[model samples]
Target chain A: MTGRLSNKKEKSIIEAARKRFAHYGFSKVTMEEIATDVEMGKASLYYYFTTKERLFQAVIAVEQQEFVREVESILQKNILAAQKLHEYVGKRLRYFQELLNLGTLSVHSFFNIKSVFKKSFNNFEKQELLLLTRILSEGRATKEFNNKLPKETAIVLLHILQGLRLRTLKKIKGQQLDEKSYKNLQKEMTLAIDIFIKGIKR
Target chain B: MTGRLSNKKEKSIIEAARKRFAHYGFSKVTMEEIATDVEMGKASLYYYFTTKERLFQAVIAVEQQEFVREVESILQKNILAAQKLHEYVGKRLRYFQELLNLGTLSVHSFFNIKSVFKKSFNNFEKQELLLLTRILSEGRATKEFNNKLPKETAIVLLHILQGLRLRTLKKIKGQQLDEKSYKNLQKEMTLAIDIFIKGIKR
Candidate 1:
């Protein structure tokens, strides 16, 4: 009972903190404000999260988990591998845009704390690679793909996606990922994936 | 006669500055040092180039011109489109590695002056797009490539290459682009180009 109650308390804290951070940004939001919003003592909030960065990471983790769950569902769907790959690209772009819009940090701030967030980013990449590998393997197994090296292709694809995102972000430096730019990026990514699909298709 | 002599003087100064900057980096190397190396007075160096930054830009322009000349020569060669593309990719990687190794600026310093260098970078990209479009168009005209939108494909390809480079640099932040990483990048880029070639082939 005590464990369950503590979990509930932690969840509420994270929820309160997310809203605060999203509204005011990571540097602007304070732990005391979060505690006040959560109706918890500052000391109790500290017990849950040692630092604001830690809390920010927790929020990001939750968001990442949600994205993974969605991707996993798509993976489980009975569909053509090509369709899955397209869906993955579309979802990946949307998720990334949403993440950029999280308001907890601007694009510049995110880069500023890159070292602090490197661990989470690495974890996310691993998860993404596994998901992509499974998709590629499925396609090959179904004889829908002719690529002899699914794992290598998956790794390359991941790097390509990351590179594309970085380019877009750099182009719009200091500004939020606006709708027009997002659509432009979406179109280019979709086309790039189309070419990749053709390359690997039997 | 005076105009020609001035042009020659400026060229010599730029050459001397390039050598100094490459050896000592931008911060360590001074305009006075470059003037001394070129056997000119500080006033004469100022007449030729206003600032260290301007001299750095001149050096970069010269390097960019050399790379472009090499690429153009490859374009003029009698070869299959596939071979030409593979050659282009190989040359691009090697040239970029050389640029990184110039010792004139570390990756971190390059990023620090990103805004200042934006104009030169933009010019290079425009030149690259034009060259890539030519290749794609040539391939299409010969019926060696099937891509319908040569220009669009060129733009996407440029972004992809940029993205890949950014990802690699991020992976090795704060360190020089070492030989091993260069080899790894070369391998991955070669494979990427192969996939791209397969995608566009007739």
Candidate 2:
């Protein structure tokens, strides 16, 4: 029971810290601000997090873990590779949208964190690339995808999704995208996917 | 003759400032550093460009203008839409790669400047979108491209290119990519173009 309570407290602290860091950036945010937001004493916050930077890193780690879990779940599902790839793109976009809504994913802060956590970030990215590569290989083997370079096509697909996320951040903030815009984006995405499949088709 | 010399001096100062800003970012870079690089006193540097922010903006303006010109040239060339789009993608990628090599483009700093120049950037994006829409419309009219959502497709296409630029920066700085990686990127880009054309073909 004590362990559970402490875990909850830690989670709450991390959530508050993520909001503060996202709103003010890592350099501008202070520990006291996080404490205030979490309705905890500064000393209690320190007892949980130790330092502001550590708290910030913890927030990012939590988000990354959540994203990984989502991707892993999709990968594990017994779906066709083409379907898996499509879902992968959609799921990743949804994950980013959730982060953006929570104000936990800004392009500027993402790059800053990448610099500080270069090794970890690179490893995480490599894992994603590997997953994509595997899916593309499966698609190629099944003759569901056009014949082309799987690795290169995977990278291109990743970039297209990233670009979509970035543009979404620019246009819509916390508000859910309207049905019309969502449909338009979906159609465009489907078109892009179709193009990839056709380009490589035998 | 005096006016011409002053104009030359201004250009030199801006060039020096661009190098400094690109290397050190806007906040960390100092006017003294730029002046030293230009072999001039700080006061003389200031005379040519009023402030560091203005100098940074000027550098951005020059790059943006050059990019616009290159894109415009590609658009104006008498070519099929499929061929034109292919060339445009290749030229844009090559242009950015050159900028990266010359140390004139930093993805991190560009994001910062993007926020500062949001209005002008949007205007430029809108202009590019308009150009793309025209080309796409022509492609459809001539039965070169299938009648897909032209504007939406254009947005996705642009997003993919931009995303590729960002991904390239990450791979390069992280020491995870090489020249061969770029060739692979080009291949994937061609694949993407081919797929789009195929999907839209009537």
Candidate 3:
């Protein structure tokens, strides 16, 4: 019963922190404020997350974990390889654009970019590569795709997705992103995916 | 004579800074060191470039300028559309991989990421898009490629190339680049280009 209670408290803390982060971002949200919001002592919040960065990691972890499930569902969809790939890229564009928006929304900013975050991000990338490789191999086996090297192709796919992510998430240094820019960004992503789809179409 | 002399001195300063920047990266190499390498007084160095960052910018500008020239040369190459695209991408892979290497080499890091750097990079990106658009259009006109959206296709090609650039230049946090890793990176680029080329082939 005590263990369950602790688990419940932890979830509440994570959720409270997530809310604050969504509003103020990682840097702006303070532990004490989070504790006040959760109606817990500041010390108790420390017991949950040792550092602000750690708490931020936990917050991002929730999103990334959800993303894993999303990728799995994309894989599970009973669809053709070309369509599967196209849909998957579309999902990635949405996910990243949202992440970009979140980053912009937050004050302290996720861009604080701790080493721990970098480590976890690399692990996530490996997972993405493995998942992409599976999709490509399955597609090749069905002869729905004929890219001879699925592993490499998978990496390229991720890279193409990443290129789109970079453009969407980060504004080009000097150019301001207006509503039209965002629309154009979306259009560009769709076009890029079409090319990738064509590239791999059997 | 004054213009010629000043230009010559500016070239020597840029060369010295480039060599130092390549060796110690941006943050590590001091203005004093670059001046010494150029055998000029520190004040003279300042006269040429008021700050270390500006000098570094000049060094990078030299590269971006060379890249423009290289793209022009690629456009002039006598080749079929698919082959030209393939060759152009290869050139990009090498150029960006080297830029990535240079970034990894510098101290304080190019990631110091000044606005000036961002503006220039955006400009370089624009140049790349224009060049890719030309090649794609030329290819389409000859019926060597059949992508219906050459302008959008050009952007995707550049994005794909940029994707390759990011992977080759930067290490994934937890991963080490061994000989095999290097070979795999090369193979991945080749395979990606092959797919893109095949996609466009009429």
Displacement of the residue B162 alpha carbon in candidate 2, Å: 1.8
Give residue A165's lDDT in candidate 3 (0 to 100): 53
- Residue B186, model 1, lDDT: 80
lDDT by residue for model 2 (A1-202), tens? 2353359778888887777765565666778888898898899888987776567667767777778888788878888776787787777666654454444443345456556656656766787888888888877887877646788767666766665555555456534555666665666667677665555555
* Residue-pair clashes per candidate: 0, 5, 4
**What's candidate 2's DockQ score?**
0.36
Best by TM-score: 1
User: Candidate 3 residues A1-70, lDDT tens each?
Assistant: 2352358787788788878866655556688999999999999889988887677667667777778889
Could you tell me the lDDT of residue A140 within candidate 3?
Answer: 91
Per-model TM-score on C-alpha atoms:
0.89, 0.64, 0.77
lDDT of 3 by residue, B22-131 (tens): 66556667889988998889998899888877776677778877878987987898888777777777787666545544443352245446677778778989988998
Tens digits of lDDT, candidate 2, B19-65? 77656556667889889988999998888777776676666666666
Query: What's the distance in Å from true for residue A177, model 2?
Result: 9.8
Instruction: Provide the TM-score of chain B versus the true chain B for each model in turn.
Output: 0.87, 0.72, 0.85
Native contacts matched by each model = 0.79, 0.55, 0.57
After the best TM-score superposition of candidate 1, give how far the Cα of residue B122 lies from its true spot, in angstroms. Answer: 0.9
What are the per-model DockQ values?
Answer: 0.81, 0.36, 0.50
TM-score, chain B, predicted structure 2 = 0.72
Model 1 per-residue lDDT at A37 = 94
